[model samples]
Target: MARVTVEDCLEHVENRFELVMLSTKRARQLATGGKEPLVQWENDKPTVVALREIAEGLMSYEFIAEQEIVQDEPLFAAFEDESNEAV
Candidate 1:
């Protein structure tokens, strides 16, 4: 149970430029001591709403991994396989 600080959230938002404006506004509010959910538009759609969920430490790899649809197992395995190709 780790804590996802405001800084961590900002970093994600910065990397995810698709929601730049939304993340910026949320980040600014956080800097000013606000702790509400951060909503943002990604590609002109309401997709990256997990900004706050990630900030609250609720967006764990385990949680997401479960929800992910493994449609391309071979493709994923090829990328995940660590052998001579990695070296």
Candidate 2:
């Protein structure tokens, strides 16, 4: 199939914001080598692979929520550290 577009993914995820969040999170995981691509890679970038996975019904918000997504330190924590250094 041709490169998966946002329109294709929208069919699976009703909300654009939610679709962006899911695709972003999935891309990050793939970039870090923390998770395997649900769809064939085909030399596509991580984000593209992620979008394709979602477009093809291979990944979904509920499914991702069920998996343990590795989260980075919260944004507030980083700001706090910077503030302490400046104080």
Candidate 3:
């Protein structure tokens, strides 16, 4: 019923882009039913619930950012190996 605005979440998440990424990732997790919902029923969409979670400081942004960085490392390494082979 309540609106979740970017400004409401900005204090918790310094970067707007990072906020968007983290929220979307959380939304995907919710969509896949991988994680339990932190908030009660509001008849909201997954993305809305995710944004609310972030705005309310229910999720850890640092943890999500670190996970994303770690997940990308292997892909980058594989790409580097392929480039080396081409060269």
TM-score of each: 0.32, 0.72, 0.67
Candidate 2 yields a Cα-based lDDT of 0.85
Off by over 4 Å in 1: 1-48, 71-87
Candidate 3 Cα deviation (angstroms), residue 87: 21
The alpha-carbon deviation from the true structure for residue 79 of candidate 2, after best TM-score superposition, in angstroms, is 19
lDDT of each: 0.47, 0.85, 0.79
- Alpha-carbon lDDT of model 1: 0.47
Per-prediction backbone clash count: 0, 0, 0
Better of 1 and 3 by lDDT: 3
Every candidate's CA RMSD: 13.0, 4.8, 4.0
Best lDDT goes to which candidate? Answer: 2
After superposition, the stretches of candidate 2 with alpha carbons farther than 4 Å from their true spots are 69-87
Q: Clashing residue pairs in candidate 2, if any?
A: none
Writing each residue's lDDT as its tens digit, candidate 3 over 31-74 gives 88466678874888899998888888887766455444345376
Between prediction 1 and prediction 2, the one with superior TM-score is 2
Candidate 1 lDDT, 1-87, residue by residue in tens? 243355766654444453455544444434453443333323332223345556655544455445445685676676667765878
lDDT: worst 10-residue window of model 1:
39-48
